[model samples]
Target chain A: MGAILEIKHVSKFFGGLAANSDVSFELAEGMIMGLIGPNGAGKTTLFNCITGYYPPSRGEVIFKGRKMNGLEPNKVCKLGMARTWQKVRPLAKMSVLDNVMVGALCRTNSLKVARDIALEQLKVVRLDRKADFLAGGLPIGERKKLEVARVLATRPQLLLLDEVMGGLNPAESEEIIQLILDIKKHGITQMVIEHDMKAIMRISDRIVVLNSGEKLAEGSPEEIVANQAVVEAYLGSEH
Target chain B: MKTILNKLGNNRGFSPVAISLWIAALAGLALFPQFVDNPYALHVMILFFLSTIMGESWNILGGYTGQYSVGHAAYFGVGAYTTMMLMQYRQIPPWLGMWAGVAVVMVVALVIGSICFRLRGPYFVLASIAVAEIMRLCAVNLKDLTNGAEGILATEIPPFKIGATVVTDFLSKVPFYYIGLSFAVLTIVATMLVQHSKLGYYFQAIREDQDAAHALGISLSFHKNVALLLSAGFTSLAGSFYAIYVGFIDPPTVLALDISVQIVLICIIGGIGTIYGPVVGSLVLVPLSEALRSNLIAQGIFKLGLASEESGVGVFLKENLAHAHALIYGILVVVVILFMPDGVLGFARKLFTARNRGNA
Candidate 1:
């Protein structure tokens, strides 16, 4: 089959600066693609363009063979795609479990249905223990996990993880990598943005690199480490 | 279902406790006026029930969706003016005039809601205030249609005397009492129905987080307008009740800023969004207001020798505390907000939940 999601030559301009310039890629079914770059490589800008947070100044973002241009983030979500913010955005006063229940409301109007789904999703994210606790009391790692559980409760066909593991310890990072794989096992297509080269290499089936809002290279990790452009863009003179 | 419901706060559908309580309250209202036929007491009850209805209606949009609208008087004024004009000139019964009032308010609220739903948070609040002011001003300046500040008035048409327990004179306040009580109960039940229905959860979701709700495929504008229209329609009914209860209506001061703020204040005091918030709020605020008013003017510690009814120092307090009464209400609202943000009932619910959580 064709790719599950296709970003065809997308260029998102914020005034004169191209936050994402001519960024193009695709995620096939069952594929876990990694989008990585040095800080400010426009990796997130590309995700935003695809997810309809920012409509590309040039070119279309297609999901499951449908155009996603000029769509609001909510509409994009209804199309069975969901994303977490780079920063946590929990409803502060609500219980931790209720935060996840919000995603289920998208698909079901019944609080009972939403609650049941949110509960199971929380268990999957290992957040069931703290479900009754107010979300404000959660640590950053648990908060990130809560975000993932919230998306899972929405039953999204495509899941985008936006630096959810950014602040985790090494052990915490490995657990998240496994969680990503487990999520893929449930037949959801995945794209994760990460700065940790080791975690990205461990989970992603394919990798795309960006530099200064431009696509620098696209290859397997082994090939990417060998590429002169990738090394120069990220490693500089470290090696 | 119970497990999930507890996890997510109250459940939908008719909980047995709510149904039984409503039924019992209705029965009591049907008979209570028999014992107490006093007109002043009747007037107090009328205003109390009216505020309850308005609070309940506003809760549909404000409490459920977290859309804090301060200008609800726009809807109330439309209802009042619609009924007053139709009854005065067209000679329509308020029974029919009330529906006309309802339609006008709903259509206007829908249009405003559709446009205003786009603006989030503080912007939406500002837009709602602007719409309410514009509507009020239009009602004021349009002298040809609305009679400007010169309002409509009708002499009190007492209910034609009926059976023994209910006389046509003061004896028939019973029917009006029943009707007011019915509206109060109906508003509460209607709020409950929407709370448990599929739409209620959508409202809760939208309130909690709009973007997250939208991502789940919920239609933001559709549900909000539905809520706003429903809220407007019900509130206008209360306005119509106010006109008939008083036998007169005016544009400028009769249906003004104070009317709008009073409804919300009652909701806040009772606990906004919760089922009994309006009822609880009306129960507390209305009686307190009445107490303040009655006690300000007179100077005697009067006691009604009737059974358990202790007549208070109402007349003297009414004379002396008129200015202070308004200030007291304002101060009370501030205290409630600062000390009990969830509202009076909301705080109570928190206590209940905390205890339950601990026991678990």
Candidate 2:
């Protein structure tokens, strides 16, 4: 299939520090691209640049062949690219259904239609039962699920999940892996920033490794595991 | 009829009994002047309605959208001054001039929104206060336009007319009461519509988490502006009403920082983000403040034999308590914030659910 998103030499700077340095990758349609990096490797910053939360200091992010350089986050979302935060931000005082309905509202002005979309997504994430519960009261694992359901309600063509499995138990992480695979079955392209190596391997069609804000390697999961530089850069002296 | 009752009952705790009670209360309020001919009681009712309008207006932005604009006096003053000036100088009736006030407030709200909405949290609050203070200063200095600090005083309101028929002669408190009641109802209905709409969800989303709301494609600037416009418009209407009813408009009276604080207090004291919160707040604050200002509270204390009229405690309360309404307000706010951070409605809800659970 065709590439749905292309990141070309994207670099982001905060003062003199380079948060993302000349990172380049292409995400094909309907494929799950795993982004793995060590701590402080600028994975989240790159996601920020790609998702229009911040403008890249250099290079381009072309999504659906449109250059997304200085667009606001809301504009980027309306253009069908939605991302979840690493620190899952739920609308705490609102009900869980309302949280998802906010995302669903991005597509339709009708509260009834948004409710339907929200409920459907809630069911997808198995949060339908707790739809009326205050979002702040949810556990971290379920908050992550709510985040997924919310973005899914936006009907995004491309989803960028920043550490969706972070802070989750193995079972919870397994469920997210299954959810990501299921999303792929619907043909929505995804780029996932995940720390769980085995989980990423199982879900990712291809993996791109980042080391100190630069792409260390990009290949299939088997090829990535065998890459010596990636092994050294990521695993450090332990590998 | 049964299906309609069931529908209303099923939707968000609006039981048939509650709906009937609401209808009864509204009917009583509508017919109050007919039963009670006392001008002082009618005056108190008008003040209650005015306070309701102001509080409900502020609640739209501060409570639901979480913008917390402490500078709402800018809109209030603009509305009061606009209508008063138009009537006193240009010979326009207040009914028409109120629309002019709304238009001017919209422009002012947009300008304030552009400047203040760029800042978040406490900075936004500070910016709003600063902007309102600037507006107050302008009103004080601009002698040619706003009549400077002396302010605009109109002794007579032009009688409203449709063709040859005069609607009212502007001689009675009765007309003012009806006008205040209608404005109060309008604000409440507006808040209710906002609370139940997608617009409210967007506003609440922005309030809960601005970044998350942005990611959900809710434009922070756009939604915040919409909330501010709705809030400022209603507040302006209240200002116009107050200017007409009170027959005076001064910078200190209409545009001061305390005016903004009082508006916010009305919502916070009752509950923010709920339709009835401001109404409850006005219900408590208006009568309490009025009683304090009129020394009725001290009179009641002496009448109840809590203190002998000649006692030092009684003398001190009787003499000083009228001026101590502000102090009482301060203490009340502190108590509410300390014990009921979610405000009265939320606190009441917590108590109600806890009691129900205990019963179960």
User: DockQ for all models, in order?
Assistant: 0.49, 0.92
Task: List per-prediction Cα lDDT, in the order shown.
Answer: 0.81, 0.93
Question: Which numbered prediction scores highest in lDDT against the true structure?
Answer: 2
lDDT of 2 by residue, A1-239 (tens): 88899999999999999988898989899899999989999999998998889999999999999999999999999999999999999999999999999999999999889999999999999999999999999999999999999999999999999999999998999899889999999989999999989989999999999888899899999999999998898667675
RMSD of each: 5.1, 1.4
Tens-place lDDT per residue, model 1, B49-163, is 8889989999998998888887788898889888888877777767678899999888888888888888989898788778778877887788888878777785544444335
Can you list the residue pairs that collide in candidate 2? none
**How high is the lDDT of residue A128 in model 1?**
99
TM-score chain B for all models: 0.84, 0.97
Q: Which 10-residue window in model 2 chain B sums to the lowest lDDT? A: B5-14
